[model samples]
Target: MSLFWSIYVGVLVTSNLGLAIFLYIYGTRVKIPIEGDGTTGHSWDNGHLRESVRRLPRWWAMMSLTSIVVAIGYLILFPGFGNYKGLLGWTSEQQVSEARVANAQKLDQMFARYRQYPVNQLAGDSTARQYGNRLFQDNCAACHGTRAEGGHGFPALTVNGDDGDFVVSTALAGRTGVMPPWGAVLGEQGVTDVANYVLSLSGAPHDAARAQAGEPRFKETCAACHGAEGKGTKALGAPDLTDHSWIYGGDLASVEQSIRDGRTGHMPAWKDRLGEDQLRLIAAWLRYNALTEREASIAAPVADARR
Candidate 1:
């Protein structure tokens, strides 16, 4: 802290402590007027309520004194009064760093066996998956949902399950997917027609006449990236529009907005921060979770039939 702030804080703390001490001492010792029959002259409420004084309870006084002592001790041992640094020279930053080191040491022991196995082999281990899940929640849960279900513009991790190779590679090295804005190129009506046609690909509710008008424009303009069939190209990070899963949305309005405004998504690389092994672990966890979800979805109908 600056010199002025340090002095200001010190003064405030000291003044408060001093005032408390003064009050405690003065309150116990000060004498009050006592008329005959051991009552002060003060009276109220038709003389029913009369002011009376008594000595401070020994227990209460002791407790207050003890609290003052504890407060002084705390100030002496810890950094409470601005930048005093305290007698113990302890710091919150130092404590955090020490905790992190201890945690790393514990994790090193756990990950020792994992180091022996390659990422592909590690993907099958339950222990690795658990650790990977923790890492995912810590790092990737903000963009991707806690369950990896994806948010607004973020792509769901479970959509394309391919043993996690592609996801892991993408994680280690960041990738950017850009859908260039076409509002300027395509007029308002043209954008709406294209959106309707895009929605029609997935069998969503759309005007057939509008879709028919939009198909020719889509083939000429969007075919390069989205493909003529509108299934999209995975190699280019272009999403498959034919599927039910939509990143922005599958609705007419949302689709129109996407066409007009376009969208850009970025997945930052974690190689330098998380290392290759950690990335592999996270990828394995994602793959395992996706497979679990897929299996449950398939079993739901069978279970319902059996019931």
Candidate 2:
């Protein structure tokens, strides 16, 4: 606090303490004249009651003294006395720093062990998976879902995190999936036709006539990039439209909008944001989660025998 404010607070506290102490002592000892009826000259409740004055109880006086002593001691020993640090020399910042050091020390050993394993092997470990889950929940949960299902603009992390294709790209910094809005090039009608064609690539319900009409334009323009199957070139960070799984949305209207105005979403580059240790752990976690989902496909007897 400023000097003036500190002086003001000191004055107020002094005045309050002085008044309370005086009242406590004087109120108990002061004499009050009483009627012979053994009551003060006060009546209430239709004369059925009369006020009686009593000295403060010995226990109450002791309690009050104890509280005052504690307050004074606290003011002398703590920061309450106008920015005066306590004799104990404790501070919140110091406490937080100490806690962080302790936490880091504990994690140091874990990191050492983690660094020994390859990213692929680490993904299979139960302990690493647990730690990775917690780390992901803390850092990645905001953009990705709690379960990593994803939303309108966010990529589905359930598949992305675990799969080799996505994990490799996502790690060593992150990836930006940008489909620049093609609206200006296509105009309104051309945008709609191309969107239908994109949907047809996935076997999604679309207007065949419009998609056919868009084929020439698509081959000349979009095919150079989106590919003949619309399977998107990962080399360009282009999404596989044929999966019917959209980074934005899968509906006809949303698909049309993506082609019309395009979409740009950024998943932050993690190179500088996180330490190398964290990056490796996160990559392992992603692979672990994605591998589990592929079990059904690989569970077949014929597939197992081949493996």
Candidate 3:
């Protein structure tokens, strides 16, 4: 608090305490005239009630005095009298700092054990995966779905069958996925044709004539980042156009807009935020889930053949 406010508060508290003390002393010592029947010269309800002066009860007076003493002691030892940090120099911030330090110390021990193994190997560890899944839910579930299946613009952690390394590295370093605006380069019709062609790669519904018209244009312009087959390059963070896993929507209008205005997907670096060990744990969880999905995909055909 400012000096003015501090002094003002101190004066207010001191004045209140003084007033309480004055009231207690005056209440006990003050004498009043009494009638012969041991009642003060006051009556109500046609003399059925009469005011009687009585000494303060010993227990009540003692308790009140004790409370005053306790209040004084509390003010002296703790922060109540403005801007004073108290005898022990305790603060809410200091308490929180101490708690965080203790929590970090415990986490360090757990992380040290995790550091001994690689992320892929750690994915097989049940206890590690459990911790990782919890961390993922807390941090990543907002953008990536609860099951890491991804959302409208957010990329999936495991859904597209991406390797653990890709997810871990992306998290550690961060990435900005930018599909530049092609509206100026390719006119509105060209943008629509290209969107249709891109859709055809994934076998989504598209006008055959429009796809044919844009095929050559796509090969010339987009084939560099997105391969001729539209498989996409991992290094470029270019999404696989052939899959149903569309970062943006798979609809013709959505695809056209993507081509016209373009899209930018950014994944914030977690190296500093999560640290190495925690990132590895999260990567392990993602890998384990992806592996499970892969296994399920493999088993499905076998089970179908048996049937």
Candidate 4:
């Protein structure tokens, strides 16, 4: 602290403590005159009640004195009185540093054991998944939903056929997908037609005539990134239209808007924020959830058939 602030704080502390001590001593010893009724003649409620002066209870006085002593001891031993370093020379920063070091050591031991198993195998371990779930919630849950079901602009982690390696790489390095604007190239009617054609590829409701008209244009333009089959290119982070998985809505208007104005999706790198082992844990949890969901999806139809 600056010398001025340090002295200011010291003076304030001394004054406050001195005032408290004076009050304690005076409260115990100072005499108050009482009328014959044993009241201090201070009336309240139109004299229905009168204030009474009694000695500070022995127990209360002792407790107050003890508290004052404890406060002094605390100030002497800790860094509460101005800029004084205290007798123990303890610091909150030092305490926090020690705690962080201890935590890091524990984490090192835990990750050491986890390193033995592949992420796919680690996904099966309940303890690893628990840790992974916490990591996912803390870091990944904002864009991807709690269940990884994703929102309008964000792609669903659950549906993507990304393995643990892909997930880890993408998370560590991040990825950006750009869909260039085709508005000028395609024109207004062309944009609409191409959108309908794109919808048709996904088996979504679209005008048949428009879809037919736009197919040639789609193949000529969009097929480069979207693939000839509209299945998408994983290397480029292009989304599969055929799977009916739309990062930006699958609706006619939404599709038209995307083709016209274009879209950009960015996944931020977690390399500095999260370590490789932590990322692997998250990837494992995501893989496990995806597999479980896929299995459930396959079994649902079988169960329905039995019914």
How far is each candidate from the true structure, as Cα RMSD in Å? 5.2, 4.8, 3.6, 3.0
Best by lDDT: 4
lDDT of 4 at 256: 99
lDDT of 1 by residue, 1-307 (tens): 9999999999999999999999999987888879996778789999999888688999999999999999999999999998899999999999999999999898778777787876667668898989999999999999998988887898877766435778878888888998988888888999999999999998899999999999998998899999999888766788878866788978888998888888998889899999777887888888888788878877987999999
lDDT of 4 by residue, 1-307 (tens): 8899999999998998899899999999998999999998999999998998788899999998998899899889988778998999999999999999999999999999999888889889989989998999999899988988788889988876238888889999999999999999999999999999999997899999999999999999999999998988878988888865688999999999999999999999999999898999998899899888888877987999999
Model 2: pairs clashing at backbone N, Cα or C within 3 Å: 181-261, 181-262
List the candidates' TM-scores in order.
0.68, 0.76, 0.80, 0.88
- Model 4: runs farther than 4 Å from truth? 31-54, 300-307
Q: What TM-score number comes out for model 1?
A: 0.68
What is the C-alpha local distance difference test score of each model?
A: 0.86, 0.76, 0.87, 0.90
Per-residue accuracy of model 2 over 241-271 as CA lDDT, tens digit each: 7763677788889987888877787777766
lDDT of 3 by residue, 1-307 (tens): 8999999989998999988888878877788789999999799999999999898888877887888889888888888798987898888889999999999999999999989888888999999999999999999999998888888999766654336677778888999888988889889999889999999998899999999999998998889899999999887888889867788889999999988998999989999889778888888999889778768877987999999
Point out the worst 10-residue segment of candidate 1 by lDDT.
156-165
| Candidate 4 Cα lDDT to native | 0.90
Q: 182 in model 3: Cα distance from truth in Å?
A: 3.1
Off by over 4 Å in 1: 44-50, 117-131, 178-264, 272-278, 293-307
Q: Between which residue pairs do clashes occur in model 1? A: none
